[model samples]
Target: MQLVLTVLEIVSPVFILALIGFGWVKAGHEYRIEFVTRLAMTLSIPALIFVALVNAKIEPAALTSLLMAATVGFAAVTAVAFVAVKVFKLEIRTYLAPLIFGNTGNLGLPLAYFAFGDEGLSYAVVVFAVMALWSFTFGVYVTAGGGHPGKVIKEPLVGATLLGGLFLWQGWTLPTFAMNTLDLLGQIAIPVMLITLGVAMARLQVNSMGRAVALSLGKVILCAGIAAVVGQWFDLAPVPFAVLVVQLATPVAVTSYMLAEKYGAQAQEVAGLVVASTFLSVIYLPVLLGLLL
Candidate 1:
Protein backbone atom coordinates (compact mmCIF):
# COMPACT_ATOMS: atom_id res chain seq x y z
CA MET A 1 0.00 0.00 0.00
CA GLN A 2 0.99 3.61 -0.39
CA LEU A 3 1.14 3.99 3.37
CA VAL A 4 3.67 1.19 3.72
CA LEU A 5 5.89 2.78 1.13
CA THR A 6 5.55 6.13 2.80
CA VAL A 7 6.70 4.67 6.10
CA LEU A 8 9.62 2.94 4.41
CA GLU A 9 10.65 6.10 2.62
CA ILE A 10 10.67 8.00 5.89
CA VAL A 11 12.56 5.33 7.84
CA SER A 12 15.05 4.08 5.23
CA PRO A 13 17.49 6.98 5.34
CA VAL A 14 17.68 6.92 9.14
CA PHE A 15 18.62 3.23 9.33
CA ILE A 16 20.89 3.52 6.30
CA LEU A 17 22.88 6.31 7.89
CA ALA A 18 23.15 4.29 11.05
CA LEU A 19 24.17 1.24 9.04
CA ILE A 20 26.90 3.29 7.41
CA GLY A 21 28.37 3.99 10.83
CA PHE A 22 27.95 0.38 11.81
CA GLY A 23 29.68 -0.73 8.63
CA TRP A 24 32.39 1.86 9.07
CA VAL A 25 33.27 0.47 12.48
CA LYS A 26 33.15 -3.12 11.26
CA ALA A 27 35.51 -2.21 8.46
CA GLY A 28 38.12 -1.44 11.16
CA HIS A 29 37.95 2.30 10.75
CA GLU A 30 38.69 4.55 13.65
CA TYR A 31 35.85 6.74 14.97
CA ARG A 32 36.38 8.72 18.08
CA ILE A 33 32.81 8.62 19.38
CA GLU A 34 33.48 10.88 22.32
CA PHE A 35 34.94 13.62 20.16
CA VAL A 36 32.14 13.40 17.63
CA THR A 37 29.52 13.37 20.37
CA ARG A 38 31.07 16.43 21.96
CA LEU A 39 31.07 18.24 18.65
CA ALA A 40 27.42 17.44 17.97
CA MET A 41 26.19 18.18 21.47
CA THR A 42 28.21 21.33 21.97
CA LEU A 43 27.79 22.85 18.55
CA SER A 44 25.65 21.22 15.90
CA ILE A 45 22.67 20.04 17.94
CA PRO A 46 22.35 23.34 19.74
CA ALA A 47 22.34 25.15 16.45
CA LEU A 48 19.67 22.83 15.14
CA ILE A 49 17.46 23.32 18.16
CA PHE A 50 17.82 27.07 18.13
CA VAL A 51 17.20 27.39 14.42
CA ALA A 52 14.25 25.02 14.40
CA LEU A 53 12.43 26.82 17.18
CA VAL A 54 13.17 30.23 15.75
CA ASN A 55 11.88 29.36 12.30
CA ALA A 56 9.00 27.03 13.18
CA LYS A 57 5.74 28.06 11.52
CA ILE A 58 3.40 26.59 14.07
CA GLU A 59 1.68 28.59 16.75
CA PRO A 60 3.35 28.92 20.15
CA ALA A 61 0.22 27.68 21.94
CA ALA A 62 0.35 24.36 20.11
CA LEU A 63 4.00 23.94 20.96
CA THR A 64 3.30 24.85 24.57
CA SER A 65 0.60 22.21 24.69
CA LEU A 66 2.95 19.64 23.23
CA LEU A 67 5.62 20.58 25.75
CA MET A 68 3.28 20.08 28.66
CA ALA A 69 1.98 16.85 27.19
CA ALA A 70 5.50 15.50 26.75
CA THR A 71 6.36 16.38 30.34
CA VAL A 72 3.32 14.61 31.70
CA GLY A 73 3.96 11.60 29.48
CA PHE A 74 7.52 11.35 30.75
CA ALA A 75 6.36 11.67 34.32
CA ALA A 76 3.85 8.90 33.78
CA VAL A 77 6.55 6.74 32.22
CA THR A 78 8.85 7.33 35.18
CA ALA A 79 6.10 6.32 37.57
CA VAL A 80 5.30 3.13 35.71
CA ALA A 81 8.98 2.28 35.25
CA PHE A 82 9.51 2.69 38.98
CA VAL A 83 6.58 0.40 39.75
CA ALA A 84 7.77 -2.17 37.22
CA VAL A 85 11.26 -2.08 38.64
CA LYS A 86 9.94 -2.65 42.12
CA VAL A 87 7.51 -5.40 41.11
CA PHE A 88 10.14 -7.20 39.11
CA LYS A 89 12.78 -6.61 41.78
CA LEU A 90 15.21 -5.26 39.20
CA GLU A 91 18.21 -3.17 40.16
CA ILE A 92 16.91 0.35 40.58
CA ARG A 93 20.06 2.14 39.49
CA THR A 94 20.53 0.19 36.30
CA TYR A 95 17.08 -0.55 34.91
CA LEU A 96 15.10 2.46 36.02
CA ALA A 97 16.87 5.18 34.05
CA PRO A 98 17.05 3.18 30.85
CA LEU A 99 13.39 2.34 31.09
CA ILE A 100 12.35 5.92 31.78
CA PHE A 101 14.38 7.79 29.17
CA GLY A 102 14.26 6.88 25.47
CA ASN A 103 16.57 8.00 22.65
CA THR A 104 14.56 11.11 21.76
CA GLY A 105 17.49 13.03 20.37
CA ASN A 106 19.40 11.13 17.72
CA LEU A 107 16.71 8.76 16.46
CA GLY A 108 13.56 10.69 17.27
CA LEU A 109 14.49 14.02 15.73
CA PRO A 110 15.40 12.76 12.26
CA LEU A 111 12.39 10.47 12.08
CA ALA A 112 10.10 13.39 12.85
CA TYR A 113 11.66 15.55 10.17
CA PHE A 114 11.35 12.83 7.58
CA ALA A 115 7.84 11.79 8.54
CA PHE A 116 6.30 15.22 9.04
CA GLY A 117 8.84 17.67 7.66
CA ASP A 118 10.10 20.93 9.24
CA GLU A 119 7.09 21.51 11.43
CA GLY A 120 7.57 18.06 12.90
CA LEU A 121 11.19 18.89 13.59
CA SER A 122 9.96 21.93 15.45
CA TYR A 123 7.60 19.80 17.54
CA ALA A 124 10.24 17.10 18.03
CA VAL A 125 12.74 19.55 19.48
CA VAL A 126 10.32 20.51 22.24
CA VAL A 127 10.03 16.88 23.27
CA PHE A 128 13.79 16.48 22.96
CA ALA A 129 14.30 19.52 25.15
CA VAL A 130 11.99 18.08 27.77
CA MET A 131 13.82 14.74 27.63
CA ALA A 132 17.20 16.42 27.82
CA LEU A 133 16.15 18.39 30.86
CA TRP A 134 14.65 15.39 32.62
CA SER A 135 17.42 12.94 31.79
CA PHE A 136 20.19 15.30 32.80
CA THR A 137 18.56 16.08 36.11
CA PHE A 138 16.47 13.18 37.42
CA GLY A 139 18.05 10.46 35.29
CA VAL A 140 21.52 11.32 36.53
CA TYR A 141 20.26 11.39 40.07
CA VAL A 142 18.72 7.96 39.72
CA THR A 143 21.94 6.44 38.42
CA ALA A 144 24.46 8.34 40.53
CA GLY A 145 22.31 8.72 43.68
CA GLY A 146 22.96 12.47 43.47
CA GLY A 147 24.03 14.97 40.84
CA HIS A 148 24.83 18.63 40.40
CA PRO A 149 21.72 20.56 39.41
CA GLY A 150 23.82 23.47 38.20
CA LYS A 151 25.51 21.22 35.67
CA VAL A 152 22.20 20.90 33.84
CA ILE A 153 22.18 24.62 33.15
CA LYS A 154 25.71 24.39 31.79
CA GLU A 155 24.67 21.96 29.07
CA PRO A 156 24.60 23.50 25.61
CA LEU A 157 21.35 21.77 24.79
CA VAL A 158 19.68 23.37 27.77
CA GLY A 159 21.06 26.77 26.85
CA ALA A 160 19.77 26.41 23.33
CA THR A 161 16.34 25.30 24.51
CA LEU A 162 16.00 28.23 26.85
CA LEU A 163 17.31 30.69 24.29
CA GLY A 164 15.12 29.20 21.60
CA GLY A 165 12.06 29.33 23.79
CA LEU A 166 12.79 32.96 24.52
CA PHE A 167 13.01 33.77 20.86
CA LEU A 168 9.84 31.86 20.12
CA TRP A 169 8.05 33.79 22.84
CA GLN A 170 9.33 37.19 21.70
CA GLY A 171 9.17 36.54 17.95
CA TRP A 172 12.84 37.31 17.63
CA THR A 173 14.97 36.40 14.64
CA LEU A 174 18.70 36.42 14.16
CA PRO A 175 20.28 38.29 11.30
CA THR A 176 19.98 36.50 7.94
CA PHE A 177 23.71 35.69 7.66
CA ALA A 178 23.87 34.40 11.22
CA MET A 179 20.76 32.28 10.69
CA ASN A 180 22.25 30.78 7.51
CA THR A 181 25.51 29.96 9.26
CA LEU A 182 23.68 28.33 12.15
CA ASP A 183 21.48 26.45 9.70
CA LEU A 184 24.56 25.05 7.96
CA LEU A 185 25.99 23.91 11.31
CA GLY A 186 22.63 22.47 12.23
CA GLN A 187 22.58 20.35 9.06
CA ILE A 188 25.43 18.16 10.30
CA ALA A 189 23.54 17.02 13.38
CA ILE A 190 21.15 14.44 11.90
CA PRO A 191 23.53 12.43 9.68
CA VAL A 192 26.25 12.49 12.28
CA MET A 193 23.86 11.40 15.02
CA LEU A 194 22.43 8.56 12.98
CA ILE A 195 25.94 7.32 12.11
CA THR A 196 27.06 7.66 15.69
CA LEU A 197 24.10 5.56 16.77
CA GLY A 198 25.16 2.82 14.39
CA VAL A 199 28.76 3.06 15.49
CA ALA A 200 27.72 2.83 19.13
CA MET A 201 25.56 -0.18 18.44
CA ALA A 202 28.36 -1.84 16.52
CA ARG A 203 30.74 -1.31 19.45
CA LEU A 204 28.31 -2.27 22.24
CA GLN A 205 28.40 -5.76 23.72
CA VAL A 206 24.93 -6.99 24.60
CA ASN A 207 24.65 -9.33 27.57
CA SER A 208 21.41 -11.04 28.63
CA MET A 209 19.69 -10.87 25.30
CA GLY A 210 16.42 -12.30 26.57
CA ARG A 211 15.95 -9.78 29.33
CA ALA A 212 17.11 -6.98 27.09
CA VAL A 213 14.58 -7.86 24.42
CA ALA A 214 11.78 -8.12 26.91
CA LEU A 215 12.63 -4.81 28.51
CA SER A 216 13.00 -3.13 25.18
CA LEU A 217 9.62 -4.38 24.01
CA GLY A 218 8.03 -3.32 27.25
CA LYS A 219 9.55 0.14 26.92
CA VAL A 220 8.28 0.67 23.39
CA ILE A 221 4.79 -0.41 24.27
CA LEU A 222 4.62 1.57 27.47
CA CYS A 223 6.09 4.75 26.00
CA ALA A 224 4.00 4.70 22.87
CA GLY A 225 0.86 3.97 24.85
CA ILE A 226 1.47 6.78 27.28
CA ALA A 227 2.30 9.23 24.53
CA ALA A 228 -0.81 8.32 22.57
CA VAL A 229 -3.02 8.79 25.59
CA VAL A 230 -1.35 12.04 26.58
CA GLY A 231 -1.47 13.50 23.10
CA GLN A 232 -5.18 12.86 22.88
CA TRP A 233 -5.76 14.10 26.40
CA PHE A 234 -4.03 17.34 25.51
CA ASP A 235 -5.90 17.53 22.20
CA LEU A 236 -2.73 17.83 20.14
CA ALA A 237 -3.02 18.46 16.42
CA PRO A 238 -2.37 15.45 14.19
CA VAL A 239 1.26 16.13 13.37
CA PRO A 240 2.23 17.01 16.93
CA PHE A 241 0.38 13.99 18.23
CA ALA A 242 2.19 11.64 15.89
CA VAL A 243 5.54 13.26 16.57
CA LEU A 244 4.99 12.87 20.32
CA VAL A 245 4.42 9.16 19.99
CA VAL A 246 7.48 8.64 17.81
CA GLN A 247 9.83 10.67 19.98
CA LEU A 248 8.79 9.02 23.20
CA ALA A 249 8.89 5.57 21.63
CA THR A 250 12.48 5.81 20.47
CA PRO A 251 14.94 3.17 21.75
CA VAL A 252 17.12 3.29 24.83
CA ALA A 253 19.76 5.94 24.34
CA VAL A 254 23.46 5.05 24.01
CA THR A 255 24.01 7.64 26.71
CA SER A 256 22.21 5.36 29.17
CA TYR A 257 24.87 2.68 28.69
CA MET A 258 27.62 5.23 29.13
CA LEU A 259 26.04 6.54 32.30
CA ALA A 260 25.74 3.04 33.68
CA GLU A 261 29.40 2.41 32.92
CA LYS A 262 30.42 5.65 34.57
CA TYR A 263 28.29 4.99 37.63
CA GLY A 264 29.06 1.28 37.93
CA ALA A 265 25.46 0.17 37.51
CA GLN A 266 25.55 -2.97 35.38
CA ALA A 267 27.01 -1.34 32.27
CA GLN A 268 26.85 -4.52 30.20
CA GLU A 269 23.20 -4.96 31.05
CA VAL A 270 22.47 -1.40 30.03
CA ALA A 271 24.44 -1.99 26.86
CA GLY A 272 22.26 -4.99 26.19
CA LEU A 273 19.14 -2.83 26.55
CA VAL A 274 20.57 -0.23 24.19
CA VAL A 275 21.40 -2.78 21.51
CA ALA A 276 18.16 -4.69 21.89
CA SER A 277 15.97 -1.62 21.90
CA THR A 278 17.71 -0.11 18.89
CA PHE A 279 17.37 -3.27 16.85
CA LEU A 280 13.74 -3.55 17.87
CA SER A 281 13.15 0.02 16.70
CA VAL A 282 14.20 -0.86 13.17
CA ILE A 283 11.32 -3.33 13.03
CA TYR A 284 8.66 -1.57 15.08
CA LEU A 285 9.25 2.03 14.07
CA PRO A 286 8.20 1.49 10.48
CA VAL A 287 5.11 -0.35 11.61
CA LEU A 288 4.34 2.37 14.11
CA LEU A 289 4.83 5.01 11.45
CA GLY A 290 2.49 3.14 9.13
CA LEU A 291 -0.24 3.26 11.74
CA LEU A 292 0.49 6.86 12.68
CA LEU A 293 0.44 8.05 9.12
Candidate 2:
Protein backbone atom coordinates (compact mmCIF):
# COMPACT_ATOMS: atom_id res chain seq x y z
CA MET A 1 0.00 0.00 0.00
CA GLN A 2 2.76 2.41 0.92
CA LEU A 3 4.66 1.60 -2.26
CA VAL A 4 1.50 2.11 -4.27
CA LEU A 5 1.01 5.54 -2.79
CA THR A 6 4.60 6.49 -3.35
CA VAL A 7 4.51 5.54 -7.02
CA LEU A 8 1.23 7.37 -7.52
CA GLU A 9 2.46 10.51 -5.78
CA ILE A 10 5.56 10.62 -7.90
CA VAL A 11 3.96 9.90 -11.27
CA SER A 12 0.42 11.30 -10.92
CA PRO A 13 1.30 14.96 -11.38
CA VAL A 14 2.86 14.18 -14.74
CA PHE A 15 -0.31 12.47 -15.92
CA ILE A 16 -2.55 15.21 -14.53
CA LEU A 17 -0.45 17.89 -16.23
CA ALA A 18 -0.72 15.89 -19.46
CA LEU A 19 -4.52 15.85 -19.08
CA ILE A 20 -4.45 19.59 -18.57
CA GLY A 21 -2.55 20.00 -21.82
CA PHE A 22 -5.07 17.74 -23.48
CA GLY A 23 -7.89 19.92 -22.15
CA TRP A 24 -6.23 23.04 -23.52
CA VAL A 25 -6.10 21.50 -26.97
CA LYS A 26 -9.69 20.32 -26.61
CA ALA A 27 -10.63 23.92 -25.78
CA GLY A 28 -9.06 24.92 -29.07
CA HIS A 29 -5.86 26.37 -27.73
CA GLU A 30 -3.45 26.99 -30.59
CA TYR A 31 -0.50 25.56 -28.72
CA ARG A 32 1.82 23.55 -30.90
CA ILE A 33 3.29 20.29 -29.59
CA GLU A 34 6.12 20.25 -32.13
CA PHE A 35 7.44 23.58 -30.96
CA VAL A 36 7.46 22.33 -27.39
CA THR A 37 9.31 19.17 -28.45
CA ARG A 38 11.88 21.16 -30.37
CA LEU A 39 12.42 23.48 -27.42
CA ALA A 40 12.93 20.52 -25.12
CA MET A 41 15.37 18.76 -27.44
CA THR A 42 17.44 21.83 -28.28
CA LEU A 43 17.47 23.65 -24.97
CA SER A 44 15.88 22.27 -21.82
CA ILE A 45 16.91 18.60 -22.04
CA PRO A 46 20.54 19.31 -22.87
CA ALA A 47 20.72 21.83 -20.06
CA LEU A 48 19.28 19.35 -17.61
CA ILE A 49 21.62 16.59 -18.71
CA PHE A 50 24.69 18.83 -18.79
CA VAL A 51 23.99 20.17 -15.33
CA ALA A 52 23.33 16.75 -13.90
CA LEU A 53 26.44 15.19 -15.37
CA VAL A 54 28.75 18.08 -14.51
CA ASN A 55 27.86 17.95 -10.82
CA ALA A 56 27.55 14.18 -10.62
CA LYS A 57 30.21 12.25 -8.73
CA ILE A 58 31.73 9.46 -10.74
CA GLU A 59 32.79 6.14 -9.26
CA PRO A 60 34.55 3.68 -11.50
CA ALA A 61 33.16 0.54 -9.88
CA ALA A 62 29.59 1.73 -9.73
CA LEU A 63 29.87 3.08 -13.24
CA THR A 64 30.95 -0.37 -14.38
CA SER A 65 27.76 -1.96 -13.09
CA LEU A 66 25.68 0.80 -14.64
CA LEU A 67 27.44 0.40 -17.94
CA MET A 68 26.86 -3.30 -17.75
CA ALA A 69 23.22 -2.71 -16.99
CA ALA A 70 22.85 -0.24 -19.83
CA THR A 71 24.57 -2.46 -22.37
CA VAL A 72 22.58 -5.51 -21.38
CA GLY A 73 19.33 -3.59 -21.06
CA PHE A 74 19.66 -1.98 -24.47
CA ALA A 75 20.66 -5.20 -26.17
CA ALA A 76 17.75 -6.99 -24.55
CA VAL A 77 15.27 -4.45 -25.83
CA THR A 78 16.75 -4.41 -29.31
CA ALA A 79 16.70 -8.17 -29.54
CA VAL A 80 13.10 -8.34 -28.39
CA ALA A 81 12.15 -5.63 -30.86
CA PHE A 82 13.81 -7.57 -33.61
CA VAL A 83 11.94 -10.73 -32.72
CA ALA A 84 8.65 -8.88 -32.47
CA VAL A 85 9.13 -7.26 -35.86
CA LYS A 86 9.86 -10.64 -37.44
CA VAL A 87 7.04 -12.43 -35.64
CA PHE A 88 4.41 -9.80 -36.22
CA LYS A 89 5.77 -8.80 -39.63
CA LEU A 90 5.41 -5.23 -38.39
CA GLU A 91 6.66 -2.13 -40.13
CA ILE A 92 10.00 -1.38 -38.58
CA ARG A 93 9.63 2.39 -38.29
CA THR A 94 6.06 2.29 -37.07
CA TYR A 95 6.77 -0.24 -34.33
CA LEU A 96 10.45 -0.36 -33.50
CA ALA A 97 10.92 3.09 -31.93
CA PRO A 98 8.47 2.50 -29.10
CA LEU A 99 9.89 -0.93 -28.42
CA ILE A 100 13.39 0.43 -27.98
CA PHE A 101 12.90 3.84 -26.41
CA GLY A 102 12.19 3.76 -22.68
CA ASN A 103 11.44 6.87 -20.61
CA THR A 104 14.96 7.19 -19.25
CA GLY A 105 15.32 10.86 -18.54
CA ASN A 106 12.05 12.39 -17.39
CA LEU A 107 10.62 9.34 -15.60
CA GLY A 108 13.63 7.17 -14.87
CA LEU A 109 15.88 9.83 -13.39
CA PRO A 110 13.49 10.91 -10.66
CA LEU A 111 12.51 7.33 -9.91
CA ALA A 112 16.16 6.43 -9.47
CA TYR A 113 16.69 9.43 -7.22
CA PHE A 114 13.70 8.49 -5.13
CA ALA A 115 14.69 4.86 -4.78
CA PHE A 116 18.44 5.12 -4.48
CA GLY A 117 19.35 8.69 -3.51
CA ASP A 118 22.55 10.42 -4.60
CA GLU A 119 24.68 7.35 -5.24
CA GLY A 120 21.99 5.53 -7.15
CA LEU A 121 21.11 8.68 -9.05
CA SER A 122 24.72 8.99 -10.05
CA TYR A 123 24.58 5.48 -11.48
CA ALA A 124 21.30 6.34 -13.17
CA VAL A 125 22.87 9.47 -14.61
CA VAL A 126 25.41 7.38 -16.46
CA VAL A 127 22.75 4.96 -17.69
CA PHE A 128 20.50 7.84 -18.65
CA ALA A 129 23.32 9.54 -20.48
CA VAL A 130 24.12 6.43 -22.50
CA MET A 131 20.45 5.79 -23.24
CA ALA A 132 20.05 9.40 -24.37
CA LEU A 133 22.92 8.99 -26.78
CA TRP A 134 21.50 5.73 -28.05
CA SER A 135 18.02 7.22 -28.43
CA PHE A 136 19.31 10.19 -30.38
CA THR A 137 21.63 8.20 -32.59
CA PHE A 138 20.74 4.59 -33.28
CA GLY A 139 17.14 5.01 -32.21
CA VAL A 140 16.79 7.81 -34.73
CA TYR A 141 18.50 5.73 -37.34
CA VAL A 142 16.01 2.92 -36.81
CA THR A 143 13.09 5.30 -37.06
CA ALA A 144 14.45 6.83 -40.26
CA GLY A 145 15.15 3.46 -41.86
CA GLY A 146 17.61 4.47 -44.61
CA GLY A 147 17.23 8.26 -44.63
CA HIS A 148 20.71 9.46 -43.52
CA PRO A 149 21.85 8.10 -40.19
CA GLY A 150 24.36 10.95 -40.24
CA LYS A 151 21.61 13.36 -39.31
CA VAL A 152 21.19 11.79 -35.89
CA ILE A 153 24.88 12.29 -35.27
CA LYS A 154 24.44 16.05 -35.43
CA GLU A 155 21.70 16.50 -32.83
CA PRO A 156 22.33 19.15 -30.19
CA LEU A 157 21.72 16.71 -27.35
CA VAL A 158 24.49 14.51 -28.72
CA GLY A 159 26.86 17.48 -28.85
CA ALA A 160 25.88 18.52 -25.33
CA THR A 161 26.69 15.08 -23.94
CA LEU A 162 30.09 15.17 -25.58
CA LEU A 163 30.88 18.65 -24.29
CA GLY A 164 29.65 17.78 -20.82
CA GLY A 165 31.88 14.70 -20.76
CA LEU A 166 34.92 16.74 -21.77
CA PHE A 167 34.21 19.24 -19.03
CA LEU A 168 33.85 16.51 -16.43
CA TRP A 169 37.02 14.76 -17.59
CA GLN A 170 39.03 17.97 -17.30
CA GLY A 171 37.49 18.79 -13.92
CA TRP A 172 36.13 22.02 -15.33
CA THR A 173 33.43 23.84 -13.41
CA LEU A 174 31.01 26.30 -14.93
CA PRO A 175 30.92 29.79 -13.56
CA THR A 176 28.17 30.47 -11.00
CA PHE A 177 26.18 32.54 -13.45
CA ALA A 178 26.32 29.87 -16.13
CA MET A 179 25.44 27.12 -13.66
CA ASN A 180 22.46 29.11 -12.46
CA THR A 181 21.31 29.64 -16.02
CA LEU A 182 21.61 25.95 -16.78
CA ASP A 183 19.74 25.14 -13.57
CA LEU A 184 16.89 27.42 -14.52
CA LEU A 185 16.69 25.91 -17.98
CA GLY A 186 16.92 22.40 -16.59
CA GLN A 187 13.90 23.04 -14.42
CA ILE A 188 11.83 23.55 -17.56
CA ALA A 189 12.66 20.22 -19.18
CA ILE A 190 10.46 17.89 -17.16
CA PRO A 191 7.30 20.00 -17.17
CA VAL A 192 7.65 20.82 -20.83
CA MET A 193 8.16 17.17 -21.66
CA LEU A 194 5.09 16.17 -19.68
CA ILE A 195 2.89 18.86 -21.22
CA THR A 196 4.15 18.14 -24.70
CA LEU A 197 3.49 14.47 -24.13
CA GLY A 198 -0.04 15.31 -23.04
CA VAL A 199 -0.67 17.47 -26.07
CA ALA A 200 0.59 14.73 -28.34
CA MET A 201 -1.58 12.15 -26.61
CA ALA A 202 -4.58 14.40 -27.06
CA ARG A 203 -3.98 14.36 -30.78
CA LEU A 204 -3.89 10.56 -31.05
CA GLN A 205 -6.91 8.93 -32.70
CA VAL A 206 -8.95 6.31 -30.86
CA ASN A 207 -8.28 3.80 -33.61
CA SER A 208 -4.57 3.95 -32.86
CA MET A 209 -5.10 2.99 -29.22
CA GLY A 210 -5.36 -0.76 -29.77
CA ARG A 211 -2.16 -1.01 -31.72
CA ALA A 212 -0.41 1.22 -29.22
CA VAL A 213 -1.41 -0.98 -26.29
CA ALA A 214 -0.16 -4.12 -28.00
CA LEU A 215 3.20 -2.54 -28.81
CA SER A 216 3.63 -1.07 -25.34
CA LEU A 217 2.89 -4.36 -23.63
CA GLY A 218 5.53 -6.03 -25.72
CA LYS A 219 8.11 -3.40 -24.86
CA VAL A 220 7.45 -3.22 -21.13
CA ILE A 221 6.59 -6.77 -20.11
CA LEU A 222 8.88 -8.59 -22.49
CA CYS A 223 11.85 -6.28 -22.05
CA ALA A 224 11.52 -6.23 -18.27
CA GLY A 225 11.29 -9.98 -18.17
CA ILE A 226 14.52 -10.21 -20.08
CA ALA A 227 16.15 -7.76 -17.67
CA ALA A 228 15.00 -9.78 -14.69
CA VAL A 229 16.60 -12.98 -15.93
CA VAL A 230 19.80 -11.15 -16.80
CA GLY A 231 19.86 -9.32 -13.47
CA GLN A 232 19.57 -12.55 -11.50
CA TRP A 233 22.23 -14.24 -13.57
CA PHE A 234 24.59 -11.32 -13.03
CA ASP A 235 23.82 -11.13 -9.31
CA LEU A 236 22.92 -7.45 -9.23
CA ALA A 237 21.87 -6.19 -5.82
CA PRO A 238 18.15 -6.00 -5.10
CA VAL A 239 17.72 -2.24 -5.03
CA PRO A 240 20.02 -1.35 -7.90
CA PHE A 241 18.78 -4.22 -10.02
CA ALA A 242 15.18 -3.30 -9.31
CA VAL A 243 15.97 0.29 -10.22
CA LEU A 244 17.45 -0.90 -13.49
CA VAL A 245 14.49 -3.14 -14.25
CA VAL A 246 11.97 -0.41 -13.48
CA GLN A 247 13.84 2.01 -15.65
CA LEU A 248 13.78 -0.52 -18.43
CA ALA A 249 10.07 -1.14 -17.92
CA THR A 250 9.10 2.49 -18.40
CA PRO A 251 6.91 3.47 -21.35
CA VAL A 252 8.04 4.48 -24.77
CA ALA A 253 9.80 7.81 -24.44
CA VAL A 254 8.02 10.97 -25.51
CA THR A 255 11.04 11.78 -27.66
CA SER A 256 10.46 8.72 -29.84
CA TYR A 257 7.44 10.41 -31.40
CA MET A 258 9.40 13.61 -31.87
CA LEU A 259 12.07 11.75 -33.73
CA ALA A 260 9.46 9.86 -35.71
CA GLU A 261 7.71 13.08 -36.66
CA LYS A 262 10.96 14.78 -37.61
CA TYR A 263 11.98 11.89 -39.82
CA GLY A 264 8.49 11.20 -41.22
CA ALA A 265 8.58 7.65 -39.92
CA GLN A 266 5.16 6.54 -38.80
CA ALA A 267 4.69 9.50 -36.48
CA GLN A 268 1.09 8.71 -35.62
CA GLU A 269 1.96 5.17 -34.64
CA VAL A 270 4.87 6.32 -32.52
CA ALA A 271 2.73 8.96 -30.82
CA GLY A 272 0.02 6.43 -30.06
CA LEU A 273 2.60 4.07 -28.56
CA VAL A 274 3.95 6.83 -26.35
CA VAL A 275 0.52 7.68 -25.01
CA ALA A 276 -0.50 4.08 -24.45
CA SER A 277 2.71 3.06 -22.75
CA THR A 278 2.84 6.10 -20.50
CA PHE A 279 -0.72 5.56 -19.29
CA LEU A 280 -0.20 1.87 -18.73
CA SER A 281 3.09 2.49 -16.96
CA VAL A 282 1.12 4.00 -14.09
CA ILE A 283 -0.29 0.54 -13.42
CA TYR A 284 2.64 -1.57 -14.56
CA LEU A 285 5.51 0.22 -12.82
CA PRO A 286 4.29 -0.06 -9.22
CA VAL A 287 3.40 -3.71 -9.64
CA LEU A 288 6.79 -4.43 -11.18
CA LEU A 289 8.54 -2.58 -8.39
CA GLY A 290 6.49 -4.23 -5.70
CA LEU A 291 7.52 -7.63 -6.91
CA LEU A 292 11.14 -6.71 -7.58
CA LEU A 293 11.84 -4.47 -4.62
TM-score for each of the candidates: 0.99, 0.84
Residues forming the 10-long window of minimal summed lDDT in candidate 1: 144-153
C-alpha lDDT (0 to 100) for residue 144 of candidate 2: 77
Best by the TM-score measure: 1
Can you list the residue pairs that collide in candidate 2? Answer: none
* lDDT (tens digit, per residue) of candidate 1 on 143-261: 99997778899999889988998898899999999999999999999999999999999999876799999999999999999999999999999999999999999999999999999
* Per-residue error (Å), model 2, residue 241: 3.0
Error of 2 at 252 (Å): 2.2
> Candidate 1: deviation at residue 117, Å?
0.6
